[model samples]
Target: MNENKEYFVNEEDFIVSKTDVKGRITYCNQPFLKIVGATQEQLLHKPHNIIRHPDMPR
Candidate 1:
């Protein structure tokens, strides 16, 4: 894990992302992109864990 900074989503905002039953990302909304700092192309078909922070508890 590298040095990562946290990005916050608004309390009233909804961050939408969809994953397959196997836990691979299938779709993600713009708000999800902003928070993850990733482009749609980067996220498509990726594992949902791609955006997980190293500091996060397992």
Candidate 2:
């Protein structure tokens, strides 16, 4: 991971919440929340890519 990167939450499981620069619940699915073990509030502050699993190619 990039040490310079900063985020409200970390990508651990399957919570891939995509949001714009502003904090808003733009996109999210049931599987995302369930696998990550997080609520909507958690991703609200976090970035859209916080849930981007490492397996995803750059």
Candidate 3:
């Protein structure tokens, strides 16, 4: 079963990412990878939405 979990970020924590014109991830910072629980190899070139929460509006 899938569970919905919320993650909190600190004020000093800054997540940065860059996506291509097609919304594919091209660049992401260390904080982004850590928060998303993904490695650079896994996230690069993948759709940015892959990490989006289901509750988020389109």
Candidate 4:
């Protein structure tokens, strides 16, 4: 089953990621990886949208 949950980041926490011109993930910081529950190996070269929230506007 698909589960919906909310994750809150700390006020001082900063999430950072970078994508290629084609929108493929190139780099992501540790905080971003933790929030997305993915590893560098899993996210690298993948589409940035792979971690987009459903409620987010396209």
Tell me the tens digit of each residue's lDDT in model 3 across 23-53.
Answer: 9999998888889999999999999999999
Tell me the lDDT of candidate 3. 0.91
TM-score of 4: 0.72
Write candidate 4's Cα lDDT for 1-58 as tens digits: 9999999977438898999999999998898888999999999999999898999987
Can you tell me which runs of candidate 3 are displaced by over 4 Å? Answer: 1-13
- Which pairs clash (backbone N, Cα, C closer than 3 Å) in model 3? none
Of 2 and 4, the candidate ranking higher by lDDT = 4
CA RMSD (A), model 4: 12.2
The runs of at least 3 residues in candidate 1 whose Cα sits more than 4 Å from the true structure, single-residue gaps closed, are: 1-12
Candidate 4 residues lying further than 4 Å off, grouped into runs, are 1-12
lDDT of 4 at 12: 36
Sort every candidate by lDDT, greatest first: 3, 4, 1, 2
C-alpha displacement of 23 in model 2, angstroms?
Answer: 9.2
lDDT of 2 by residue, 1-58 (tens): 6578666754554545666666555766677788777777777656655665899964
Error of 2 at 3 (Å): 56
Q: 1 or 4: which has the higher TM-score?
A: 4
- lDDT by residue (tens digit), candidate 1, 6-58: 99867438889999998889998888899889999999998898899999975
Give lDDT for model 1: 0.88
Worst lDDT run of 10 residues, candidate 4, spans 8-17
Which candidate wins on TM-score?
Answer: 3
Q: Please identify which of the two predictions, 2 or 3, would achieve the higher lDDT against the true structure.
A: 3
